[model samples]
Target: MDHGRPKPDLIIFDCDGVLVDSELLSCRCLSEVLAEFGLQLSVEQALELFLGRSTKAIEQYYRDLLGQALPDDFLARLRARVLETFAEALQPIPGAGAVLSKLQTPRCVASSSDLDRVSLSLDVTGLAPHFGDRLYTAQMVRHGKPAPDLFLHAAGRMQADPARTLVIEDSVSGVQAARAAGMMVWGFVGGAHYRARDGRAILSAAGADRVFAHMSDFWEA
Candidate 1:
């Protein structure tokens, strides 16, 4: 925590881009799968549209664009490919493990991804031990990012007041959700997926109280 900001009662982490560097891998896999279903998106476009969203969001996106429902099997296919790719190549964000190791604040994961994917991401990156069963997912809420429901849910479950929670996120929607939930948020831009864009400005515009590029700077003011 920074000296300028009140120490948080609890910290809520968004898994994909904040804890695990899986945004690029997941987005590329999503693009490949969507192409097979007659929807095309470059990896950059996929990241832009779905970086902090759920599979249900993806399905609805394609449904709106193509003007019909995606095949019932679409989410299943996407999840399988993403999990397989994750098991093979996912890694934690740079300095993520060290930060978690040193932090004394109570913390938990609340991600837009499913529990299965969030669990596997942590396990493969050697980050699972830090969270244990404190992981939360979009499946736990009726709505996902850009909606305040998920973050609010996590804060309640963790027994922290929403106003006293700190949300660390790497996407606009995540930052927005945290703000909507009345929590202070720091926008993280250290993931491989952010290397090509101005993530700091984007997240700041989305209402992040702080925007930082590396996990090593997590406590800096």
Candidate 2:
């Protein structure tokens, strides 16, 4: 039964859309925050521009658009709102818990979110025990997704050979990053946000080796 490519030595998962169903809430918050700055962004637009990107990248984009740095309290306020919202509304992706529980490969989470947000997402969804200190965030690297730095850093730290690592991602930037890291990559589109968005198309365009639409459908690597 074991045929074709070599089995993976490690698995890497992205957080928001891949592990937890937080993208809809996060994009809503992004829409709200950007509206205050007179940009009038819709949740779909926010998802297009900010999904799988770090807070620093988002802030810099806003600054570039507005021609000035954001207010000191902007990030703090956003974080507070997002954390409160997560405590109340965040949920794990459908079947993600069962999939993680059954997975035999050593796995870790690597996300564009900062450590605090990543930790809280895992905590709220009961996925924390699955990963614990195995979490890696873009803040831990010099560059985020689409640049290969974060994926390379995670693979290096996990002691996984890039050639034998399997990456599961839900965004274009994340897929690009994992592929650039010299690893096998699959695109996941299980998040509710994909209902109205064409995430799979973008993921395919970004060069994922395979694409799956549900956690239960994840391929064995």
Candidate 3:
């Protein structure tokens, strides 16, 4: 007997903190970059503003923070540093690989990060081969997370019905995007960036179908 097919036709995963433990590394890299300009920012501040956003959005945020225009090449330098740091220490979140390996449904990665960064993270975490050609980036959509364009774009590209997709996200912005795209959302709370009360509130306000405190919890659910 064919188990009557799984519930969701597709499973879309967020790359950064959900699949790879790169959130804190990203925060640290940006903080170090800002320090070069004589600006100091806490990890929490970086997470609040930069997590789940595109590089362009992150550049705009620094532009506002510095009260002046950033050099056009600033983003390039930042990207290089982030990539180097991630390559040196990148690892998958606890149980991430096992969970992915156990899934029976078609899976795809949809990330707010640029294609290069997304590819690098997945490569380091050893999840690149698992996804094959099913990677979707914010550049493929009209807008990033908090807009649903990325998730919708991924679903459309996969030819999967949006109603039958399940989005696994670790940020409120990502969860909101998936919800707006008409897919079920599962909020991942096992990452370092989402340890605060505000993070929990954001997940709730965004209407996550379920909040998982651990990878095992998600797998069990």
Local distance difference test, each candidate:
0.92, 0.87, 0.83
- Give the local distance difference test score of model 3: 0.83
lDDT of 2: 0.87
Residue-by-residue lDDT tens digits, candidate 1, 121-197: 99999999899999888999999999999999999999999988999999999999999999999999999998999
Model 1 lowest lDDT segment of ten: 1-10
Clashes of 2: 0
Q: Which stretches in model 2 have alpha-carbon errors above 4 Å?
A: 1-4
Q: How much RMSD separates candidate 2 from the native structure?
A: 1.7
> Residue 42 lDDT in model 2?
88
Per-candidate RMSD vs. true structure? 1.1, 1.7, 3.1
In angstroms, the error of model 3 at 187 is 0.3
Model 1: colliding residue pairs: none
- The regions of model 3 sitting more than 4 angstroms off are 1-6, 62-67, 196-198
lDDT of model 2 at residue 101? 93
Error of 3 at 6 (Å): 8.1
Of the two candidates 1 and 2, the one with more favorable lDDT, higher being better, is 1
